[model samples]
Target: MDIVFEELDYCETHMGDLMLRKRSIPSLDGKIIYEVKLGEEFLMSSLFHDAEVALSHLGLDSFGTKQVDVVVGGLGLGYTAQAALEFPNLRSLTVIEGLSEVIGWHKRGLVPLGEKLTQDSRCRLLHGDFFELAQSANLDPEHAGRKFHAILLDIDHTPEHFLHLSHGGFYQPEGLEKMARHLHPGGVFALWSDDKPDEGFCKVLESVFASVEAHLVEFDNPILGGTSSNSVYVAYAQ
Candidate 1:
């Protein structure tokens, strides 16, 4: 028999009830999976990371072997950021996280890939709300009015479901247009969605971008004992 253990941590944020936990699930082979949570919801588990990694590959694939600057909006488990760094042609990667505790986890080496992503020379961890920063004239505090080759986001559940009510605005045409201003010409904007692609959302992107695509990323779900899927929305700047 395998024993399950959980050590919970708490934090306070304007968004809502914030909590993070280290869940250890053991199996017959002594394999274990670590998970992070927010409130009552399961945020990210080490076992299911294919979709997170796919967010990087599918988003950056079109760039080919060219050196490019990138920004990852969320840094859950560091899977997406780590995947972006795997591209040798990637020049720089800046990860903007809403919660300071999440960034501290990587600095403190609490998560598996956190330490490695933090140690990478090409990766820069910044403390800020990604949605707010994306709309700002200066995306990065160090570099004013800077633009990136690619901007990948994995913050909300989907266009219809948002973590905070304020986040809802970012999905609108005006908000998306502001984000586009932070992208270099022909740059890509990618977002990870927990739900299937929404046609309405695609139309909104189409209005603001030169091109748009939604990729269905499938992965094995150990919890459900079946396959699961997520959507990665990629758009190009004009």
Candidate 2:
């Protein structure tokens, strides 16, 4: 297969080091999308569409009926953010991206598809660590008594197949506890994973929230009928 490379950039996430590259392949539905890698490991390919669906599965209602505020942890090609914007009841949408360049790519039109979401009136893009924002959102005095209707995290590959070591904390007991604090009572906490996290994540969710559920999302292609499984875990605060 002949692959055409467009641009390459470096990024360091909590997990470790990653190289973001743009590539073009005729077989890839003739569309060019960014691909992410950690050292030699193939973290994620742009061809997959499950990320957007996982992000959108949070199921938030329009603000007219009930105001909803959302905090999305990773921007990632803007699919998730784009889906979140579909909600009419959304009061505010804050997207926290750890990489400044990723955000820049969206602004400069390199990733033209994501630009509108970043520029939307309801959206605010923050260039910083997602965990820090998670912590601040939970404890900030100014935001006291305020909580997000939905907290959607699509960082790392998945809890079970993490690209970075530090990402493990997000699936741990302490991490889930802190994450739960940021969610409004009855609000949803949705996590996207490349694969199921060996039941440990569910146990952690159970320990922190009143209910936990998992949904399996499978991808099928036209030619080979390619299939990959991704899981969405939803935890609700009592």
Candidate 3:
């Protein structure tokens, strides 16, 4: 029999009723899955992190052989951040997370890859609202007036299906333009969406970015016992 172990660290964020839990499923056997929820809505799960990792792989791949400085918004389970560090030439990585408890999990080595991410000298985890920071001229508050080679985000379900209303603004042209300002020339902006690419959103990105592309990443869903897909939106900064 598989045992499900869960604990709620804390709740009552700006978003409301946030909970972090752990589970072991029959399908996963010995593997433990970490999950986060806002109210009744399931936000992220460790079991379904293929697209999160792919966000870094596809975004960094476009940069080719250059040593890159990267920023990852949302550090859930640290999959995306861990993926970003996989590149050998990665110079520095900044993971900006909204929830302080999530950041603590990594520093305390509570999750499987937590120690790997926290121990890396190249990575820094800061607590803040990713949406607000992304719209500012500086992506990282600690190091103001600095730009990055790539910025990968996995915070929301999609631009249209935002986790919070406050994030809705950043998906638009004006807000995205602000994010673009902090990117080095030819820097990459990649977003992980639970839904397929939105044509209208792509149009919005094209207006601010030099080029834009959408990629569908396929992965197996252990719960559904079938293949599932998500979209990766990449916008290149000039």
Give the top-scoring candidate (TM-score): 3
1 or 3: which has the higher lDDT? 3
Candidate 3 matches the true fold with a TM-score of 0.95
Give the higher-lDDT candidate: 2 or 3.
Answer: 3
Candidate 3 lDDT, tens digit per residue, 61-151?
Answer: 9777799999999998888899999988899999999988789877887778888998899999999988898887677888879999999
Q: Write the per-residue lDDT of candidate 2 for residues 1-238, one digit (tens) a residue.
A: 5667865668676555767788776775556767866677865566776655665655553224687888888876777777788776678888888777778767777664566986789987778777665655543234565678888888777776565565677677787777778777788888888775447778878998888887787887543676767787877788
Extract clashing residue pairs from model 2.
15-164, 62-89, 63-89
Determine the C-alpha RMSD for candidate 2 after optimal superposition of all C-alphas. Answer: 3.2
Query: Could you tell me the C-alpha RMSD of candidate 1 in Å?
Result: 1.6
lDDT of each: 0.86, 0.72, 0.88
Predicted structure 1: clash tally: 0
Q: Candidate 2 overall Cα lDDT vs. reference?
A: 0.72
Model 2, residue 43: distance off in Å is: 3.9
For candidate 2, which ten residues in a row score worst on lDDT? Answer: 133-142
Judged by whole-model lDDT over C-alpha atoms, candidate 3 comes out at 0.88
